[model samples]
Target chain A: MNLTQGTADPRPANPVRVVIVDDHAIFRSGLKADLGPSIHVVGEAATVEQAVAVIAEQRPDVVLLDVHLPGGLGGGGREVIAGSAALLGSTRFLALSVSDAAEDVVAVIRAGARGYVTKTISGAEITDAVFRVAGGDAVFSPRLAGFVLDAFGTAPADIADDELDKLSARELEVMRLIARGYSYKEVAKELFISIKTVETHVSAVLRKLQLSSRHELTKWAAERRLL
Target chain B: MATIPVRPPLARSSDRVIAGVCSGLAVHLGWPVKNVRVGMALATLAGGAGLVFYAWLWIMVPTADEAARRNARRPASPIAPAVSQPSGPGAFAPGIASPAVQAQGAAAADMTAAPLPGPPSAAGASPLRGASGSSTADAGQPEATPWFRFRSMKYGKEILLGCGLLLVAGIMIAQMLGVDVPLGTLIPAAAVLGGASIAWMQLDETRRAGLVDKTKADQAGGWARLAAGLALVVAGVLVMVSGSGSWEQTWLALLSSVAVLGGVVLVLLPWALKFWRDLESERAGRIREMERAEIAAHLHDSVLQTLALIQRRAGNEHDVVRLARAQERELRGWLFQDPGREAGQLSDRIKAAAAEVEDLLGNAVEVVSVGDAAMTEAHEAMVQASREAMFNASRHGGGTVSVYLEASEAQAEIFIKDRGPGFELSDVPEDRLGVRESIIGRMKRHGGTAAILNTGTGTEVRLRLQSAGTDAAEGKP
Candidate 1:
């Protein structure tokens, strides 16, 4: 199913610019071929060093990242995001990797990536994820939401004070589900509410916690061990 | 008698202090008993030449009983003329013979008349002769017996000391009886007696036997030479001190004694050096042999088995290449590469194995390890079994596999858990050898345990290897 289809594409005139970072040459070529005309492939890299250089040089609208790569400071995908920290506002990152490991998902999301999805997603789904990330939205695979939540759902014990207690009960449930890497559709279904209602609750939770995005909300919650 | 046959001299059984050689000779030569004894004693005082002669006669002469037995065995042989002739010495004074001597003569006559079956046995009859004969035979075949096979050297020294004391007693008795023995002659006689006894001790049968074995001979000869040199030095000092002479003469005597002792040591140096060298070489050879055996065992257990597996799967070119590459890396690291730097931590080794399984089965594995454990042979076995369990999980469990490792000084435990449908242990097909041989069997061989528990949620393979005591139930997840 195309999870990102319902979202609006802000850059329709200019096809979403993308740089694919993966260690496997075959997977890079296969992903480029599958994206077709809907998305524009600007550049590609096989290592963290090359990924940072290519992303900075091309200034792609969205970078499809792999969670594990061999060289260049050795933090895998997190190294690439941290290396190009100045470009994160204009250029977004969406992690696409073969690993479904909770640590890998939490690690990349905490490094300012907009979304995380396994490599098992269809070509249409991946294209939609790239457009949504370019449009300033967070996307995640269904099961991976729990890892995100467990990693960053609440403030740590020392910081678990008035800010977290300000969130309403409904807003708190929506915040936990979204920080856990759940899609808006998943959070709405789990809480028996409308998608619009889920989004409203998430916005309220973010405003109360003074967080900027779902990625930050997840990190803030994880530091508090709320999941 | 019509004819007289010449007979070899025999030790007479009667009138014997030790072997009766002097008494028998006195009888045969028709000399006065007192004259023969006095003459021999005087000869011993002159130079100890008489002692050497006595030792030789002791070896050559057969005892009276042995001689008689030989005669009886050959009845047709002509009898000795001396036997037919009446006792020559002391024949006129028959009353002087002791009752013991009469009894001995009667026993000898009775033995002569009996027809014995074999050649005359010298050593077989006398305990002394039996001991001496066996020791000499042992000396001939040194390798056939241990070095300490006989304690004869110690006993021989005791016997010599007794002989020297007896000579001293005789001198005292002679002086007390108002015989007026010259002090000059008595002193020389005592020196000669002591010298002869020391020389006799040098020919000990056990020492001769020790000389036949290289290691034993070196030790025995070294001590013997040192003792002899020290004795000679002491005697020379005594002689110089007793001689009331000039200081220049005493100085000359001391220099000669030191020179003699130095010469003896110089002669023994090469043999001692050779023995020391042999011992060192033997120790080195033993160490080399042990190292070679250890390397062979390691190759047989790991590398050789991998090579055989590769050969069997030649039809599958990918598996063959993978197996070949892994074996090559392992062998090269073991043989040529220095392990000091690249000795992998246990967690790293387990992660590497997991990577290999992932490549083989095309599945993702997450390895979570805590604590750095000393990687020993037992830990190696545990790692190998954990790899097998992971492979089985990826292939059959049909889901992402998770490997957890907890290691401490007391034990190392690895858990390979898969979030797939669990099955009973008995449900495994009979033909499948992966779980049975690779995981369970490997753990058991390492004095450890492998338990497969179907927890209803997922299958967990727990491999535990203890270093010291019974298994601990901690760290269960």
Candidate 2:
């Protein structure tokens, strides 16, 4: 369906510019073909070093990043994000992976990736994710949703002032539904709420996932150095 | 018997302690060096003939390096080429030559190696025979059993010998300063100390040899050293007691000691051989484990990656995709089997059910799980309900079905969605209990909940079960 039709860029003339970063050339070409005409493919890279340079030179609005790449001190996608830290504000990153590792998704998210989706997702779903990320919204697959739910335990009513890292009651409900494989529209209908309300709850949870607490930020920083 | 002396060439070992004579004779006869040393010492003290024999052996036998060079130049006798240069590049290169050639080389080596030592544990001992029975007995072993470790004793024996020499030097220096020690007592005392040190060195060798594959020769060698050592000490004490004893009386004492010690070794030989055989088998098992690990690494690098590439490239062909996925699953299970987490877990059971439905109906079912929980009655109920949902989606939907499972410390949840024609809960009659009895009723009976909803596009089955312990603590069912 046309899930992101209404949320298109304000200037219709300017499509969401994206750079594809994956190790497989065949997969990259296939994704370029599948991304359709709405999103423009500006540059492509096969390794971490090449990805960083291409991302900087293209200055694309969104970067479709693979969670595992070959180069740059073996840090993979996280290294690419760390290398282009200055461009995180104007350029959003959306990680796509076929890896069954939860730590990889969490590490990339903590490294300032806007969202994560599996490579198995439909072309339409990936296309919609790119636009949503470009518009400053967070996208999470069912697997990532489950990870977030597990990361932040079930929320209690009336959150205390010091529990800033905990998810809210409404956000918990939305995340649980997503973890149970619900689409945004399906979750909205299931909860008798608007799709925009569901998006707001999810984005809030995404923000918490990225900057959970000072302790978590410190842990991520240490882990990055080890990588 | 005075038969042909078809022995491994008489080459003096570079791994030697004194003049390389005893160790060289030991290797040639496939006897432990300690036994050879003790025999030579006894014979020397008896008539002074052993010292002359040792001196002749040292001059006659060539060093291992010279033997290896001579063997390299020879055209016949492939056995020497294998044993003469044990650490050479050609030693362990398997599959390099034709099978016929290898068998011929091995047979030639085995004929000369027939009486080498160590029971033939595997097939007839294949080339590479020498002091380390490990190499002689098994050809498949990639590592050469280190002979120098036993022969040289690293620096332990050297240090012991050094200390003994220093003590002798100090005694001599004191005598030169006009101390009242008699020369007769000093000479006997030196013999006692020297024999004791040699015995001590062999004891150390026995302890270290226990970890490796110790053979009959090694055990006999140790026993020989201990017997020789005690005999020497006894002879020294007898001479000290009979001050200014005649040479004939000293000879009788040494001969009796050797005879008595030989009996003790004869009694212990059988038991020591059996124990060392057990150790040999244990080492063989460890080598097998290492080979398995190597095979796993090779398969993971080549076969597993190729299967993954096949699945990715043939994504549209359902049959090809299914076959590749099944192969990948089987391979991964074999390569990364974790004994602690098996098919009995809730997630594994559900995935197995999905795979059954897929294989039976030819419909694709994707299962994803996160955060496993302890298996309980409530968890079983949820898995049963999820299995029913997957089968329903596969049979009726005629398209791909997706199953998602997430579990926390206190609760577990499953969601099954399909791209099927939507069905209304109100549309079914009371008599139709497929959804009610199997899916919804099964969950309620176990203190869980199951729901069937019609998303505007398709159908979604959601099942959730809170742990019974959590339910009681919260006072909710």
Candidate 3:
């Protein structure tokens, strides 16, 4: 759980501002209690409409979002991210859900969520992921890594290099290790690299998953409804 | 087959023709009913003896209803089973004791019993009409008046009657003007018109009923009526053309053409019915899709949120968390999965295996499978080895175990890992067969490879196998 302590800075004087956007009141309160003293709960929302409104009003450093919600075009978390697009630069969204659906994970990411984490994640890890997302770093949980691998992990010679649709060799290694439940620190140690280098590879893969225009990637994602 | 202690008391069966006397006697004597009916008819025709005997039997024997009441009081006599007569229509006696049989008899008596759900005018037009029309061919129930006669009817029936009257009036006026009218041609024409109108009414009735009940039996029954009506129309057409006294050669040609057209309609009728049913099912599916979102919302609001809360509260309690996780997975599968698509092969297997491991060890096992191969011996070995590796990870290497299985057309690979104190394979005792025989040796025997690696902080077991049909790895050994 303290895998990121060495890389992350000490808790600053001003706690990281966060807004919880889950439809469950019990989950929201439980998460708020488990988040410890390092994070400040600014606001909460249970639906897409309220999420957008609260995110805009609070202008929190990070927004913990549930992937499925009740209102706003029925797009759930994606609609919220799209609605709060203006605030994305200042207020990043870190999707926190109990759903492991690839389509939902990819949809929120494509709509500009910085990362996605399942609710099974421990309070310490979630708190760390929030800090990282707020600090403009991509947070890849093991499930998200698996999704990225399914989308981009392929043999090198099979696809032309010009497409840039597949993960790099190093990125593939990072994703596989993560998918195998290795923390970034553990992955770095296994590969004889620094945790910073591991983060860089993961962030690159996340970017490709979000903005790739290659037909193969689009076709692959579309086939699975990940797009 | 088993002989009863007592025979069914002699009584007139509800299934009666001419007071059911002959049929009841035949049933009591276990003789063919047709023999009895014929003998009675012959005796009556010859010397009036059958009439006197019939009158005596009719007075002496109780009706079926009274007999049923008598049996109810006694409770010792076994009710007679329904026996279908070998020859005569409506000769079978339905067992009065069984409610199911009674209800079936009632339904057969009135095929149009179900209330048609639509406009009041349409509903009122046809229940009795359909009953009478179907009864002539279907149930052999006696009718007070012949079904063909125009009777007190409404809506569609009145429209049909009005049209018939108008045609008759025009023909009468033409005849009055001293024109030679072919009345023979008008008769067949009227028959055709009547049959066509009957068929059209049946179609409308079926379409309206389909909206409410949507049961297969109802639709099938409706189609049968429609077919009967259409047959009548075709029969009328054949009669008019074939019965012409003059122009024999022309009549023969027209009859051949009509036969060909009839064959075509017969072939197309089934196809048309199928197309109509497909359109109906598509509309049903669309309606279900609309309701799906509403159901998803309601489930997500209460059940899903509760499961999520349980998982969150049971963070470190592995058993509670695993139970919650399994439930959530099941709930989500129900909520979003389409009706007929196959759940993926290796992924489903791995998830099932993971669930078993979680149940056994109370440790979470995260599994993800990419691509899929046909389930074969090689994939079976992979799953077994994966399960073994996962079991080892949960027992020895603690914390959450992660399993990643990637299957391609040529090969399949699996990685089972756990974050525990790293241990070397050489350090394991020789007595331990779980890793040596089950995980590593199992893959090797299946023309595959396995490796156990120490990841400094944890242990990982990797297994790979070639697809069964593919010979890509055959040349290696």
Winning model by TM-score: 3
Between candidates 1 and 3, name the one with more favorable TM-score.
3
lDDT of 2 by residue, B122-165 (tens): 22222221111122123332112222223345456668767876
TM-score head-to-head 2 vs 3, winner: 3
Q: List each candidate's DockQ score.
A: 0.01, 0.07, 0.07
Candidate 2 regions exceeding 4 Å error are A1-13, A155-164, A214-221, A224-227, B1-316, B327-343, B362-364, B368-370, B398-400, B408-410, B429-433, B466-477
Instruction: Work out the TM-score per prediction.
Output: 0.31, 0.55, 0.58
In candidate 1, which residue ranges exceed 4 Å CA deviation? A1-18, A21-27, A33-62, A65-84, A87-227, B1-370, B376-381, B398-404, B417-422, B429-458, B465-471
lDDT of 1 by residue, B236-274 (tens): 665756588764575567579679967885577567656
lDDT winner between candidates 1 and 3: 3
The CAPRI category of model 3 is: incorrect
lDDT of 1: 0.59
Model 3, B1-477: lDDT tens digits are: 112222345789777898999888888878788999999999888769798678768866878776654333211111110011010001111211122223323332233333422112212212112101122122222211221111122145557667877887898779779887886576577667676766666666566445323554375556658666666865665676566655456556766887998789667866875787687667656665655566667677767776777767775676566667566656655443322112335555777788888778878787765544445676788788889989989988778888887665467778888888878889889999988999888888888888888877788888888865654352110
